[model samples]
Target: MIFQHSLYHIRWAEDKQILELVWKPTTQDLVAEEFQAALHNFAGFGATYGVSSMLQDMRDFMDYLPPELLRWRDIVVSPRYRQFGLQKMAFLYPPEMAPKNMGNAPIQIRGYAEEFFDVYESATDWLLTDIRPRKAG
Candidate 1:
């Protein structure tokens, strides 16, 4: 593990060029600033390491970020991934918590390709593969 915090744990798979993030369930009051700062720190680490792909394990995360934070992530944090040369990102969610439209649908965030999976194996498989959805004209 390269980085560890109360909110999340980050591990790098050097051979696979994949950065894995496992979010921990929050036990105290959640703070947005802290979360943002943690994300920035991780982004810096990823940039330094030239991370190309990411696997986010969100099954243990229980807190709901506010809409503003979500917007901030979309507007601010995501571009940093692109700047760092990130190509693919996979999110693993619990089967019941998986988004309704997540089935076999390709999601593009900022300029990188993203996909959602309910199983860790599936998520890792997708991340290790080179298949990316072509943008629609």
Candidate 2:
């Protein structure tokens, strides 16, 4: 019962009890495609009332993510961009160097500040406990 899926969309890795999400928002095709998959997963897992945020590695888009990307509102909150506003606790980890109030994306309005994590595994460990995605043995 290993739920294996690889996409920017959310993945229910039942065996691992982990939901894997990766976003390639730089390109329209990747953004739209990943969002489609993520939305479907969100529907299956419940989307209406969960507070999800972006796991944005801001460094990936350092040069122009602000001017070019933030100019669009939908891009700020689009599923293609990040699976956010889902009402379930989500996370955001800006690059170590990005200033505390750096992101220019409109989602910053969510007011969910980023907490530094030493590593992804550590972050996910905390999320799994907090979110309590069903674990598989």
lDDT of each: 0.81, 0.38
What CA RMSD would you report for each candidate? 2.0, 9.5
Instruction: Kindly list the per-residue Cα lDDT of model 2 for residues 30-136, writing each as its tens digit.
Output: 44434444445544453432335323322222233344434343344444223434322234444565445322212223233233343565555454443423221
Candidate 1 stretches with Cα past 4 Å from truth are: 134-137
What clash count does candidate 2 reach? Answer: 6
lDDT (Cα, tens digit) per residue for candidate 1, span 9-50: 889888777888888887146689977886787678779898
Q: What residue runs in model 2 are displaced by over 4 Å at the alpha carbon?
A: 1-10, 15-18, 23-63, 71-118, 131-137
The candidate 2 region of ten consecutive residues with least summed lDDT is 102-111
**By TM-score, who's the top model here?**
1
Top-scoring candidate (lDDT):
1
